[model samples]
Target: EFARAPGTSDYAHNTFVDFGGVTAKNVRLTANSNWGGMFNQYGLSEVRFFSIPVFAREPSPDSGTTDVDVDVTLSFRAGREAAKHDVYLSTDEQAVIDGTADVTTVTEASHGPLPLDLGTTYYWKINEVNEVETTTTWQGDIWNFTTHEYFVVDDFEDYNDYPPDEIWSTWIDGYGILTNGATVGYPAPDWNQDEHYVETAIVHGGEQAMPFFYDNTGSAAYSEGERTFAVPQDWTKHGIKALTLYFHGDPNNAAEQMYVKLNGSKVTYDGDAANLTQTAWQPWNIDLVGFTGVNLSNVTELSIGLERIGAAGGKGVVYFDDIRLYPLFSAVVGTFSIHPWTGDGDSGISSSKTYTHTGKFTGEGTDGEPFFAGNGVYFERDTNRSGTSWTLTGAANVFGTTNPVTVADDSAALARSFFYGDEDNNHPVLTLMGLLPNTEYVTTFYTVGFGGAGLRFVDITPGDNLGYPTRVDQNGVGSGSGQLIKHTYTATSTEMSFMFDALKTGDSWHHYAFSNEAVSPNLGSN
Candidate 1:
């Protein structure tokens, strides 16, 4: 029990106490006596408790922010009782939470204009330190942010002639191996009149580059440099879409097929083979989709190689540098329905094959059977189709966020099964959310009608009066029930709206499906 001074009054004003610091599950306060010497006569008005001010709060890039610059400095407001700060940072979230991250104690409240890796998320924390206080350390809350997605795969700047750091240490070339004619780096005597193992003179955006010599002759018809990753990398993360590499030709090099392989899945460069003999640096950008059949999320190996296209034997050296991965751009392409999708549940009208959905069905012959396409698309049903009401559905995986699709509809149905708009103005408006801004997308809509005459007509618009609405009537083609209607539009923000207005009264909008795809950027050649 603790006591105050003899002159301290208990009932005159609010009481204050300094407990220094505490770690407890329960705290109790007992009043022994009042100032008037009667404990039962006095009753408490209010009681409060306060914690220690030991948190370093308000971080700069704010927590969980995206698109932060790669060269960013982290800063935080110091705690009220802190004399110094211990900053911990790492790419691993568990390491930071366990206090095992790279740490530095500093008098300042900031940590670095750091040269962090691109397209990566970093976790950090600041522990307020005060050696003189009763509580010497106060653990901080973990904060994280993602950097801009544009990181280098390799730049050849770290290669050296020393043991285990040589250019050939990580990059396996065809030196002693048979049936391959690739040689990496120069010998110690100085093939290029230089002491370094890397080519410093023919570098691209760096101090050095790999001198990849290829000799495709006799039984050895190809030359390649291969590297196996110690840890498999996920190319699909952070919205990565393309891989780019810079190569400088020697003008005397052999004319061969240039290609790259990811986990043994090869993608040949589509540019002219003569670019290998141009004596200038050229960029080759390959869409990740071109490396088909490879698990892009778990790529374990990479290879850059050249194969002789003709009977003529040739040999020369080429310089490569600055291999990098890039994120998505503002471009979209074609659209199609996920296959095995038909009426009666085999491949019938469904919104998505990948995303999960919840729905209620009434009188039907398998009207809302689920389908799986393995592609990153989702579908949802708007059960309230009687009045003009908008409803949102959840989507995962593709957008990396919740609430990706919304639908607004008005229609009438038979036995709460077959649906059609009685009024001319009643229709459905689809809103796609979490899309890349300024990106163009082509969307396909499937309209199925149960009417035998197939007399349903509707006008579909891609956006709000962006252009003339495409007028279409049900063709009753697919299994004698439906046809597809398509539209293309550019998203101005994270959200875009599409309208499907009934062009004729008594027209059916019975079952519906929607699909969208982004246009593929120029791959392999650019």
Candidate 2:
């Protein structure tokens, strides 16, 4: 049927031809003489043969929204009836529709969840067509949106003005004031210098810092400040690790100390006299590797603490600024292999399969992910005690186990060495990051008599400390001998690391010797 045939003998305007899902290759229409039998004639400005170009875009994330995932779906309303659709994505505004440009044609209403960069903007368009490539029914308009920026958790800059009720809603704490990188000083005695609390024009990232003056001379008090914010996107998914903040204050070189509490839990990491003694702004970072059940997506609070009985008679000032909670050290922790007994003990054995196509570690199994030792941008250990220490073992050592062993050799094999080897009475924690968000991964290893070896997974953005791999302080080696120790982790980030330490003397060979550790992601496939 003809598309523009309308009102007999009169000129046809605003007319449309509906083929009704007809598979037309070549269409031809014959014209007839005018009804008055006058010489046949007609006038039309445009002759359009719509072969099903994309007519409209479907509902999706609105433009300018923050904290969007890297993988997003592109949908449409009109393109569903078409045989195929072409998708184009670009950061450039003037993305063109040409034969030689980047495009993908698929037979679906929605285009790929193409991988996108973090904290970046993108432009996209869709064009619809039929199976037999004859015409373009419609061309979609250019649409754009920005991805999430999970790097800086807190800058203390997005608050209302300070006239009593105009302070930022980020915290509830001791005596303090937010300044626009101003030279803020507190009034105190001669021994009490307030310059340490003043940030002046120095800032880590943004234009604000909280210069807190703690005059703890009256009574023994706890110095703590807490914040209420949105759940930070999983930083591990973005290849970030550890939570960092900038601090400048006088050192508490004695028994007096402070600590950082995340998600209403106390970690082994705390400050000594050295932490408070710093006169210049420095980044204080804590490893997020082994905090129990920590997920960044559900993060709720962040806080800092100190003891009023410590140095300066608890009469000093500390400046806090830009308390960001993410670091991108994209890595996975483990030996990559589906089966450990199948490869050489020294060489890291992973699957022969490739992924989105980049570097290949020991990747195998259904999901094509490798066995993780631990993944993160960087791994770190912190302790306030002078003699405290932590280290990972070199390689797997063969040892006959009194306990039952799985896989290859019936004898047990040691994968890594003792955690927190020295100063049995102090706190030592190892933290790392780099994990996929809302994704599941598993860790299987062997340990013997590993006591006080607490584990916690952390949320990187805004540092929610109560994430995956919950606190397991006294988990034992399988069979109480050198056996396979396995635990599954559903992380809030790209990759997750952990911390372990010993608080007391070991029971013989029971100083937390871990071996044959394999970490794998839950990729569903054969």
Candidate 3:
């Protein structure tokens, strides 16, 4: 006899059978269950028979493999009423183990008593059986996992102090207004002195006030000096990469000049000294690489001279600030290319150009167009054309607008001919007169509405028989509705000529040219 019924539980629907009614000799019972019902109910029925078979337990994995060390552990329970079972573990493939063992066992449902090897993969399984000596064959799924080395970083730190090491100071004197007293020289007193130089905030001639020493004897008499601090021998031994000098100049006097010497070697002011003024403290960084001729490895001293190169009558003063020496470190300098004829024959213009390229610029309108125009020339990037090019459009008309355009008061203007443009007929043109002959040059144009624009060269020479006889034509249509057309001509002679034939005009085309270089008496000047 056999009976089937559902287990008395709400959480699970399990089927069980009662065989107590079977009263037969040598009786045996067998049961089978399967999933059933919408909610996963189960069915089970019992069968009574004689001669139940006995079986041996599956071999357990060696205990050594069962409790291996691992970076992390994982485990899971077989079922709510499931009894403790033996778990077996083995390596990937039945590969022969060389001194390394391959078997392991887990007594219960706990994971890892992992293997001892790091980053080794292994397979595992569990076997279920009855308390009696009867058991079923290995009936568990196989799983594999690998171990990995892991670590954590703790307590990391970095530190930096600006203007590292060697220190120097600047001071202004002869104002009779010395805060520390009547110091003899501008920036008077060496680093050991009681007083050092300070920059004046007042600006002169649109420039900063500078460090100065004055002598109001009513005669051309004034003396100013700058002192450098002592540097360690090891500093030069390791190589000094840079020197920062802080100084102030009379903003009103552009002709003032100052000389610097490090360890008695003249320090070239790579930039304009006349342009230095005392509006705020200024840092002048000098690259010591150029002074290769000087043995900086043994450098021990530094000095500066306040010489008045302007009208000797101007009794202006200069100021100085923080002076320092910085050790050389790996420094990356950005690279840029500039045409030779881009600036005046003075170093100031070149320095200004370099600064403009490397410094951040901000103005009104998108795409670098300045809202107002006062002194600055706008630099524009041309996207409609190929090749690395730029254009500078003048701000004349832009300045004439109801909302006049204005650049910063302290800024200087750099005008060029090649200005970037869109489909609109709004590009700029160059306005120079004579250009060097047969030389390749880049021309930048500036206009009021447009901004910075540039043009590269194939060849440049004097225009036809006209004063400026050579002409180069740039032809292309902008991405917009209009075309970009222009002809640049260079004058061969000093006389200026505006030949109407030299001008090309059309609804979709236009041309103009000019030379800005002075005609040189020497033919070799070209």
Candidate 4:
């Protein structure tokens, strides 16, 4: 007879026994041969019994058999790897049972084994299967035991679900909150308002306990003339998971400085105070991962304090609101998408000559007049043929025309009013007047040929003759060497002039912009 543990490989030097008709003896087994090393190949030896012998006698006394049920408990060790286990029962060692498979696997590192039959010995084994690969398996020694028919436990209760309570706050002023009352007695700040001021409210003890404090007040000791708040010593003990803050900048002051202690170490966040504007509120969210000293495994507490690090007149204020502490699986990052405008309200248009709230130009006013509440500009195109030569039909009022293109032809068509430059000529300039001075503007037009084009700006004094049309392109050819191109110019002058000439050639619709300033005077004005 031969018996071996389940899943054990039939390799060299495994324990084995052999019985020929009467007696059995221990034998050394190897991959190549059985006992006596007789055969070069190995195979299992079968045993048959002429008469069965009882190992032990059952207890008498006319004792009736009693059945009992016992619950089997299972536990696992190891971090993530130790939590997985498989339980199985079998009677006939050679027969495989399909429906009896226990599919309810436990995810927690420790779990229970349920009730089992008593008075009858049952064979059970646990397999620590690798989660990443199911085929790789390891088995524990089989356990045999009998259970009592019935057993009960008193300390059994259902699990309960509770909302997460841990919370973390970061830079909690002006970035998100708004103050309502005077400098002294303000109610809990509002989040909807556009303005924010510096202050803190004790959420746990009720407003009466710690009333809010402001940076300008004398009670809060000032460091370098600005108030500061530091994280509590027991921050980590409270189970804080995340942090949030509200911040505002002071355009005149130097950057602000704030420090926080995470997991017993202090880290600083340098605030950009010079860029702060009172007109709008900007919210900031800081993740615990943003701090290296903090133990994010289970953040307990966070401390925040601020100081004026900038120049003396660098006073800045921010409002704080919606301070929170909660447990979350992961942090969220911000994302942005580039939005382009076509004639339609939707984006992703296929045409090269598409217009945004700002217009695309082919000639003059090809795009409709500033419709839709004047959110965009109009464009025009003119490729009129005067005998063999070509001259774009000039418009009297560039902005006044509804549909600027007068000529209609597929090859020589005037689609919209756009400017083009010729590399054959020095970069001439083009200017449009009657524009808002010192304001941002976007001037877009198409040019053909030329790899890239440059802009030349000239400031025209009031009452000066500005009647100069700079050449954008010398020889305006569609294919041979030059074609359509685009250019943009940003002008910041009170009165300026612009003209376009080419630096190269390529037949494509181009778009450029002049932002943060206005356009200059036109070529015709003096």
Question: Could you tell me the TM-score of candidate 1?
Answer: 0.40
Best by TM-score: 1
Model 1 ranges off by over 4 Å = 1-58, 62-75, 78-146, 191-193, 329-526
Residues 149-236, candidate 2, lDDT per residue (tens digit)?
Answer: 5456766565433333223234565544321111123323233542422243334345556665454445435556666666454545
> lDDT, candidate 4, residue 351?
30
TM-score of each: 0.40, 0.35, 0.29, 0.25
Better of 1 and 2 by TM-score: 1
> What lDDT tens digits, residue by residue, belong to model 1 across residues 419-491?
3344555665556655565666555555443444324444455453332233344543432343444444555
* CA error at residue 387 for candidate 1, angstroms: 60
Off by over 4 Å in 2: 1-83, 86-129, 134-151, 161-170, 175-200, 215-218, 230-241, 250-258, 268-275, 293-296, 308-313, 327-526
Cand. 2 Cα-lDDT: 0.44
lDDT score at residue 518, model 4, on the 0-100 scale: 23
> What's model 2's lDDT at 263?
76
Which is better, 1 or 3, measured by lDDT? 1
Candidate 3 has its poorest 10 consecutive residues by lDDT at 151-160
- Which runs in model 3 stand beyond 4 Å of their true positions? 1-197, 200-210, 214-222, 228-233, 246-249, 268-273, 277-300, 308-314, 319-322, 326-388, 391-526
Predictions in order: lDDT? 0.63, 0.44, 0.33, 0.31
In terms of lDDT, the poorest run of 10 residues in model 1 is 396-405
